[model samples]
Target chain A: MNRRAFLATTAAGAAVAAFPAILKAQGGDTIKVGFPGPTTGPFGALAKDQQQGASVAMEEINAKGGILGRRLEILFRDDQLKPAVGAQRTKELIENERCEFIVGGLAAHVQMAINEQTKKAGKLFISVSQSDEITARPDWGPLTFHEALNPTITSRAVGNWLAQNLGKKWWILYADYAWGKQNNAVLTEVLKRQGGVLLGSTPYPLGNPEFSAHLPKILAAKPEVLVTMTPGADNIAFLKQAISFGMKKEMKIAQPLHWLPQLKEGGPDLYADIYAGINFSWQLEDAIPEAKNYVALYRKKHNEPPGDYSAYAYSAIHEVARGITLAKVVNSDAVASALIANPVYNHYKGKQWWRACDHKAFQDLWIVKGRERSKMKGEWDFVDIVQKVAASEELDRSCKEKGFV
Target chain B: MAELTLATLAAQAFTGLVLGMILVLLAIGLSLIFGLMTVVNFAHGSLYMLGAYLGFFLIGYTKSFWLALVVAPLLVGALGFGIERFLVRPLYGRSIDDPLLLTFGLSLVMVETVRLIWGKIGLTLDPPRELAGAVNLGFTYFPLYRLFVIGVTVVVLVALFVFLEKTNVGLIIRAGSRDPLMVKALGFDLGRVWLLVFGIGTALAGLAGILAGPMRGVYAEMGVTIIIESFVVVVVGGMGSLVGAIVAGIAIGEVVSLTTLFAPKFAEIMVFIVMALVLLVRPSGLFGESGLME
Candidate 1:
């Protein structure tokens, strides 16, 4: 080929590479949403599910001709579950990608870091992780919207339910972290209200492999019910060690968000008869038609049932799309106003409405019990929901009393 | 406190035996490498993880757990051979810090590679049907697979001991550990012995991984946590002392198991505290030679 033709081809390729940037620079036509979370660490599975949920929502929205006729684009960056990385990635998303809104924060610390930036930038930030009432507090920022149920609400509901149904005496084993401390406080309040007494409480450092050291103290307490908030692989290790220590035979075990698929790694029989509180479950049929559809799609795509984090991300994206439509503009302030003012938005869990007091969305919580596969019909049918906790009852009074609004 | 009395102590002692078996498999390789070559194989845990994944894949493909159990270690040993010859040999005679740094970096690469291939979620490997359930120990129910691990490690340790004591290659290895210069002066190829020692050490790590695959779910980061505890075992037992490794492995295991009876939260810290006290008393380790400081 001649130099002229070659030069033309090279120039054409360069333009193709820079097309998206040029379009973005000319006018913010595309609505960009940033997903910053741990995509390659211990919590990578949770982060990946959240990202997938958001991706699915964006895909569905774009298929129907996106919000305000502009396609919604989601940019994912792995925060590695660190606050510093989350902050750095948030800044990059805002400055470089020029995202109009931000969504997805798997870790509590990451959410706090991103919240700091979003508050200053006046951008709408949707959190899909647990971080107690800190994120929901008005002092944190009006721009932040917690899509997931806060730990305070979750703990209170769990404690109250156990006290009323299971037993009045409780033994607590909590990770020594900010979320754990807040959860303990909330549980203590709820337990007191339900005429329950805290027998004993042991705090363990997060990711400690050996739980044998704390097992004796817990067993010695001899409470009717034992409650713990250690999540991830540590949960499996703790539960199995508890069984080895004969804690399972003595006292009933309760966990907040322990019925996840990660527990299956420990073994099918590890959490047998144990009760767990969860925000969402694929098994709940009457709750949302979208959940059933999500289960089917996720199974077809990944050959497995969609977990809570996946559903949360998927629903949060749809919610964000609704806000974008309401705003009708790709501006941060406009989107924030749309999210705040909007009420009774349709999510996978039927219709969810954000409580104005705490800026937390209200949804149904399920109490599930672990059962053996032989006792069940299918492979993923390990959990049987015992009760459905209504959204109104667990509205988190602390936020209301403190006037977070 | 009464719950953790003599009866509970006996129960935890059994639990410790199971845990120690796995640790011994891990520590033997670590001890052998340090003993013969004075090289700390930081990537030992990665090799163990690799063995588990290899065993999982092998079993899936071959439909034979026995084949996987045998083949995984060989594959790991081959890889160790390549690593020692190509990557590790050049760093010989250098500061001990170099191998530590190099192996640490190698571990990162191995972990990332595993993640890239298998993803971050852990995969389970079930034990053979004959050893799948728990065995009734009268006082406490023990997992059959864990018991199998203890049995396998005992057989392996005995075989290793006999080989080292009775075989010709074992004698050369022991002599080389004492003085490589003297062994080289005797017209024996110390280079080949070093290669074999490193390969066998890594192979033992792989064996531990395969045995543990059925217990601890095989994941990329499986090595990170296990490696730290293994180091503590090595330190407590005396670096490079095979007998020390065995005693320290079981001792640490018992400490962890029994501590959970009284103070479950401090069980992890208690193991390290014990190591610190051991170090204060004997800096070279419980079994390490005082004159052989690297």
Candidate 2:
């Protein structure tokens, strides 16, 4: 062989020999967490808030010498609010990006798809979206942890409050989807248990813009309260139209969740007199030290108050990091065991514990009434916290109902 | 269920009519562009969303919904003119798929642009103070803005009808759409006419957007849902026929509205069902002329 050819072959052999070490060094530098969210569609704002919250958690973790003596990193992928897209992105995150843990699913149905992929890969999936089914039957696994409040908890809290305050006759209007249906069923059950009269129920398509058509039926029923479960833009449209039709004069309006970003968009005037259940309110800073810290940190970064959904992502990231720290390893099984064993966390609010039976986080839920414009103290102060529903195992379905018994 | 009284029926009917008018406003723009240019402008919805955004900003600046109403459509029309001139005109002679794909991509780009400019957060636009409240119609209290929308739609429809029927420019546009080469040979600037028609079509979409902004808050993906429905309206109405668009738009609207009362689960699909039934009966649509499919 020629001299030059001999040198080239030697160089190629050395490069191949060094490649695995290089890959190991690169991989070991930081722990990657996969976050697939609906960052582009209707849920874009919420997804952005989640990303910001995750960033803050990442920063804090890295500053304290990240999990297992390695820096922590988050990889965000846009799911475009589609379940198929979410699943695909999650697969890419696990298989290609080599993310050992998964976080994020802004929409209810989309989160289930993400969970399925994470389950197949045997990676811990900390879902940040709400859905009763996420923790119940067929979907939950050893590695599945839900940080957001499920519909059952939200509905029961708000339902008990509405029953005691608002009159018995209630009409329901919900976006025809999994999340909406779940809230409707749970709320209906709670209300019926309290001897509430069911006026009627209307299920409109998701993302529906027109609610005027349903006004006649609602008017005819003359319900004392109108409970709507339309999420996001649909909720705003429904309320605006409902108010315009003078339905507010006849019946009070309430919902399972009051999204902070939405409250900002819809304004105080539109949301005034409406009641909703929420996970966190910025005003909690007055009483909760963690909330104050979180709101301050988030405001410093984003120049806005942290949304309720933001707390979910923030807590999920922190808890996952804590699990890694406790396990003293990057392995999924070790982290899962650590989290499941410990089972208690308080990232940005009151104490929340993970139910060993279902892996659902039991946290305090609040019922808030929208404050009128005259009573508002600031732009973000849209709702007044009226009642707190203490977190408990009873707020969730029994283990048997979860098919765990 | 409550008794379906005459009062209830009247309320439901008015609701249906309002929805129909909004659909009419949107679908007319889609119909006009297709009728005149045979360009399936998928970007029409983006243009509508643009109008809403522009109106939102204009209202912030000018503090006048009325001024935004007049100006936003014109701004959108100007944009349509540019889109037709620079982007669409070059693809005119290619496979019809060329323009369809281009416009589809344009829609995606436009949505992203809006997001970049306005951020992903949704924003609301309030109706003018005068039209903010409900009006008692005895049957039910209806939104004054909605009633205003109906009135504006009727006036706009009447004006459009007169323009299309009686004007020389409208005649030239009609002739050029049928036989572009013949019209070009007859010494008329067919390119300008096509551009104008595209502009007018998109401006109608813009008008619909601003009108809808108050009812439905302005957001990045606001157009994505309505665009599909507008296409359904156009197809069910007959691809390029104005009268067909009007009739199908209203019929589909009423179907959706009434279905909410009787069978809420089917409200979304009722439009598609109507479209299928119409196609099964008259493939060309209610008022469509023959041979466009060829």
Candidate 3:
């Protein structure tokens, strides 16, 4: 027993004693919200924007003395839009970081993987993006709630308007994957039932760089309207090439979804005359003061207005805080019930509730037209809100038909 | 007024040809690097992407696409020279595996570096106003920018041919690629040839990238996707054979274009299917001699 041995023994004992306290400090006593998304891939900007939105929510919530007397905190980890990375990061969020709930989602496959992990972990989950199958059967769980429109809801929201004005003869160009396939199917059902002709519904392979081969076939179909279901960068490429080919002047162009960043990236000249259905917009002028306040607060703090993902996070924090207040407990079951209770939780997204059957937040979607360069008032004023469709009127019963009573 | 008239096929044929021209430009660059160094430069695509970004910067600062078209390639070529000297020269004469592994890692590093600088969102350039509209080709309306793509390809290919067939430098490169040891034994400066070949190869890819910037909507991952198809074109045309590469590029482009008319989902995979079948029969490629890969 030398002096060196004694010193080594003391250091080992102290490390063992401090480990639990370190772990506890790492978890903290605050309410932790985890957000895992594509913070490094193509959609990285959107994820970073969502992180800012989540921060804004935490700021507003903590200013009011936090949620249930505990300070609210947000933890962001880049999922890189990889499904495996998403699952692993989320497991760390719950198991290690002690995140009580999860928010923010993008890319269907990534979100779908996170759904399985969240359900297994029994952590409350809310998706702020439009994931087609997150609430679908075999994948849908009691704890997961979708805050945006699904494929069916989006299809229904813009269905009638597209058929009536853009002509019933439709040609669809979509990425060949679950989300894209679901888009093709849902749009088909809605359009065909209204006596609309299905000219060509082409599933372009995912990550296909060139549309030279596909665009001509779309034209050969002679469709009165070309509905593009490819989201993000792919959507930009298709529209630009289509515009250069004079497709916009030949026939109307539309997408199931489009975002502010994309409109900016694609340029208004290329995006002109393109119609789309969306769950949220930054330019809500009339409705709730909180919604308006959130926009103003975000603009003041970040110097840019928030998009739908930002608004979703802002409202989600408010909803969670209310759930905690009513349930009087932080347990998953209590908050879950409180969130889906009788009167339904009404927040910034209008009268909305998590449909217990499908775990989807039933809400509204708007049809919008891309503004021409000449008609634009400002840089961001790129779209004209055409119509708003309520969820109550166009609820997709398919989720109920999938063995969910 | 019918959708499936003869006019449709004629339009598709032209579309495929334009797309093939883009492939020809991209694949020729890759083939030259492989032939000159025998180092499969996976970072070729990243260089192409750099061309697009460099073009965007030049266009933004100077407000001229013409300047970008001329300058982007030269800048990328200079960068390629630096890379070959420092990063690649050390790996030369090593096991083929070393350069392959290094270039693969370099591609990811370059892409991530670009992501850090540009952010992961995409950037797009608009075609000049003069090339914005479509020109009626009697049968159908054809985009003027796409036509410009074909015109640029022809000029590039002819220039490349003249450089190869009508110059002492071209003859030396062809001889060096065939028998480098022999060329070195004959007292030729093979090192300078290596530098020139790498620079010119990457410059061609950069030119293609800038041209595609308006069409593809430049992004970090944009290079990764197009590079795979370029590799496919390289293999199909006969590795190291420029004529083979160009012919295969056009052929595959037409096949991809026409196949979509019948089976849209199959059009993408059809390129690979043809590649696989071609390899089964002619492992050396359509225009490749058996020893050309060496």
Residue runs of model 3 more than 4 Å from their true location after superposition: A1-29, A287-290, B90-92
Model 2: pairs clashing at backbone N, Cα or C within 3 Å: none
| CAPRI quality level assigned to candidate 2 from its DockQ score | medium
Off by over 4 Å in 2: A1-36, A58-102, A117-122, A321-335, A338-341, B85-102, B170-192, B235-241
Which stretches in model 1 have alpha-carbon errors above 4 Å?
A1-27, A63-65, A136-139, A166-173, A180-205, A208-226, A237-253, A258-274, A286-305, A324-342, A374-382, A393-397, A400-405
Candidate that would win on DockQ: 2
Instruction: Kindly list the per-residue Cα lDDT of model 3 for residues B1-294, writing each as its tens digit.
Output: 236878889988998998788788889988998877888888888989999999998999999999889999999999989888889999887888888788889889989998889877888888877788889888878889999989989998999999999999999999998899999999999989999988998898899899999988888887887788889999998888889899999998898888877788788789999999989999988888797544
DockQ of 2: 0.60
Interface RMSD of each: 4.3, 1.3, 2.4
Structural similarity to truth (TM-score) of each candidate: 0.87, 0.88, 0.92
Determine the iRMS, in angstroms, of model 3: 2.4
B158-237, model 1: which lDDT tens digit per residue?
99999899999999999999889999999999989989989998999999999877765577777888888898998889
Which rank order by DockQ, best down to worst? 2, 3, 1
The model with the greater DockQ, 1 or 2, is 2
| Whole-model lDDT values for every prediction | 0.80, 0.89, 0.82
